[model samples]
Target: MYPADLVKPMREELSVVGFKELHTSTEVDQAIKQKGTTLVVVNSVCGCAAANARPGARMSLDNEKTPDHLVTVFAGVDKDATDTARNHMVPFPPSSPSMALFKDGELVHMLERHHIEGRPADMIAQNLKQAYEQYC
Candidate 1:
């Protein structure tokens, strides 16, 4: 597990913008099962996450249509929570620095690690905005 001090700022990068950090499996389950659309981010300390995924997710929220709930699970830190969140994202395999959209408890959209890595934040934001337009 990453040191809490080391990950704190990374965690706050989203939490300060309204993303709830899920540290337990129960928290993950409860967040996902909530009504309306939820955006779940499998956060990581990778460069891609720092350069793109997080910025994109924050940017995506500027849209007129946004997920009702925003939550995140840290891959190397919140192991149980991340595992449970990955379970909810079945068939996609677990990947940090990934994003998923769920509407009414059903998975509707996903951005795997490959989708986030090497992409500009704007592109990722636009991709998520499109998903929000369709599924949010």
Candidate 2:
């Protein structure tokens, strides 16, 4: 795991953008169950995540009908939480720097790592924005 000090900045960046950190299995389950609309960001300790996915998710909130709940699970640092989150996201394969949009506890949309990697932030954001309007 990366040092807390190193991850603090990333955590804060997402938190300030209204993304809640799901640090426990209970938290992950609670965040996704019986919800209106939720966005699950599977965060990664990678340059592409820093430059693309996280920023993309942040910017996506500009659209109308944005998720009522926004949560995250860190891939390596928060292994248990991430794994638990992945379990909740059954049928969807594991992918860091990915996102899942759920409506009323059903997975509605997904953006995987390959989709997020090397993309321009705005482009990624735009894709998320579209999904937000359609599903959130």
lDDT tens digits by residue: candidate 2, 16-129: 988999899888888888569999999888988999998999888888668999999888888889998888777878989899888888888888889999898899889888
Model 2 accuracy (lDDT, Cα)? 0.87
Best by lDDT: 1
Q: Clashing residue pairs in candidate 1, if any?
A: none
Assess every candidate by TM-score: 0.99, 0.94
Worst 10 residues of 1 by lDDT: 4-13
Residue runs of model 2 more than 4 Å from their true location after superposition:
none
Candidate 1, 1-136: lDDT as tens digits: 9999999999999999999999999998999999999999999999999999999999999999999999999999999999999999999999989999999889999999999999999999999999999987
The residue pairs that clash in candidate 2, if any, are none
Task: Output candidate 2 Cα RMSD.
Answer: 1.1
